[model samples]
Target: MDVWDLNLRHLLAVARIVEFGTVSAAATAVNLSQPAVTQALSRLEGQIGMPLFDRRHDGMVPTVAALLLAPRIDAAMARMSSPYVTMSRLRALLALADVGSYAGASHVTGLSVPSIHRAVADLGTAMRRKLVERRGRAVALTEAGVQVVNAFRLAKVELETGLSEVAALNGQETRSIAVGAMPLSRARILPRAVTHFIRRYPMVKLGIAEGARPELVEPLRHGALDMMIGALRDPLLEEDLVQIPLFDDVPAVIARAGHPLAGTAPDRRELARYGWVVPPRGTPLRESFERHFAEVGIEMPKVPIESGSVMTLREILIDSDFLTLLSPDQVSVELEAGWLIQLGALPPELGRTIGLTCRASWRPTEVQRAFIEELAEASAGLPGALHPDLSPLLG
Candidate 1:
């Protein structure tokens, strides 16, 4: 069929009729009269050279041709909606630019007044224009309003093209890479790597999920995740997975600055005197901590608090006397702020290797490889021993 002969209005009418099951309902949806909707449908069917609906006493039912055409017509409608969506967004931004008062724009656009105000303020800063004139409670657009709107229109077009390019890229890949990491790593490392990867090859989409080691390992084995980066627990390493060591991170006992152990190097026995903040018992970190204590001929302290969230652990350490063992990277900010102090490091062998773990059969995609490269670069900049394979990736 010659799809070029079909117009958006005709497609929309057909889609609505198919959805609502009646010409009258379709007309109501499009704010057109029933006769106008029927005319559009008639025009559409004429172009396609097939009757789309089988007229029934109860309601119009879609024929085989109609069912086949429905998906194409729906896709056409979605494509047409893209321009309108951009226009609507630009209009909202323009409305904010006109009224320096976000509250006023919010009332007009049904957005929070402060949000409208912030958008206007940000746009003004970005454009270096006084787009709005504020006279008491009233707001008005300045002479620059026309120029700003025109520029925004051009920007909207560019954005739409960029989005289309990205969408096209994602559709090219039959499979996607699922990456799992600790939340801290997600915040600090993943964003830049993801951005770089997406920009270079828009077709490969990375599905990123964050969880603790215990939660991430099963997903990696079950083929739910392509690979994971976090502390590789001994049990997880023992499984049928290949571990590529990234870097070794020394575990340190962290506590608030004013805590009694802040400047003191507490012996293993003294370490057991305080309340401990530990991860759930089954976690690699918890197991490592227990094993280390046992090796030193000391009893493991009963943990007073248990949590898996790094942020929660950080906050608890900052505000309370409770001490917890954490990767140095996790507590770097707190250490810099004087909110936390590292009492002492774990024994050298107690340091865990943060690495990439994947099923032995799993193959890394180009995007994943690039991300791993970026990670290696970041790791190499740190003052520590680097894994041999990581050196080449860093270069």
Candidate 2:
């Protein structure tokens, strides 16, 4: 049979039978008699030239063909049901048009009067003919208007339902926020921040991921991440990114409590005497350390153990004489527990700035903007954290 000959009612009946597992159950589900449901299924199978279900001892089992056709049938029914869903809306619009009452249309459609006028105007434009004609204060539909209204009546319900679903999905509660950070930040900063943010707005969904600065910049640039908080490496700061310096994290020498330098304030020469645990040579921290030591007339310390994992470094520091430079935040728990001790004063120049970064053009949505405000407030009283300097940019 051609597409138009396919009966929506019969297809619905077949779907129900397959869903409910028995003719009686299907009939009850669709508010029809068992015999009526069976007949509808039979007619549908006959129209398609295939048996849609097999009557087994267990229940009504759908055939392979029926299973394959079920999705299409459901989709067709959904589309067919659309116009009825919006019928009241279309009818009210038509009534208002007939009576020349914009206010009445607004009330009936639950839209503003201007929006009602715009919708009618848009419909007329789509039809390529005037649906409504105004004479003095009165409005009436033309011949083309009657035809358009009749056509719209068939699908208005479906259209309105689809639009409403889309609008609901686009609202603030349904929106997802993308957050990217270094693994350390994810383990430390993000958990507490996310907990606080969610406690206030439980409906806002969060998409959290962690990566190094190199791995994060592209995603942030492509609009994949709403914001990132991590070490502010210079190479990652592109023209498109807006970087806000949040705090300075100085790399301090960390070692187990009984290590040689634990109780001593080591001078630059004394620090260089031990084997070090450091990041790879080309990294920002490593480079910054080299620059600072060079300025202080000290040679770069030999790193016998190089690593990227902060946790691994912590483990080594807690159990070995290996000395490593680490962010105070990473070693805070160990330091507090007396498992590790700060060896010496970290030079002011060895400090790295951690920041909140986003796309330069990123305009925060109401929810995101509010969350950022809270983040700013929460970060304020953090010891050793500094407020962002905006005076230069503002000027």
Alpha-carbon RMSD of each model: 16.4, 21.3
In model 2, the Cα lDDT at residue 378 comes to 55
lDDT of 1 by residue, 1-395 (tens): 32223454556667788888998998887778988888888876665555789989888998765654555545434432332323334555656655556665677777776666566555566557666777787776778755565445433332322223323333434324578887545644566667766776676657988888778877666456767877666655364677766667677788888998766778888888888887888766787688768987877887978886878988887777788888767767778988888888888777776667766644343455677876666555544536438432323
What are the lDDT figures for the candidates, one per model? 0.65, 0.65
lDDT of 2 by residue, 133-214 (tens): 7777767778877655544432332222222222333352344577887744654456677788888878877787776666
TM-score of each: 0.51, 0.53
Clashing residue pairs in candidate 2 are 82-158, 83-154, 83-155, 83-156, 83-157, 85-157, 86-156, 86-157
Task: Give candidate 2's error at residue 350 in angstroms.
Answer: 2.7
Q: How far is candidate 1 from the true structure (C-alpha RMSD, Å)?
A: 16.4
The weakest ten consecutive residues by lDDT in model 1 span 157-166
Query: Which candidate achieves the best TM-score against the true structure?
Result: 2
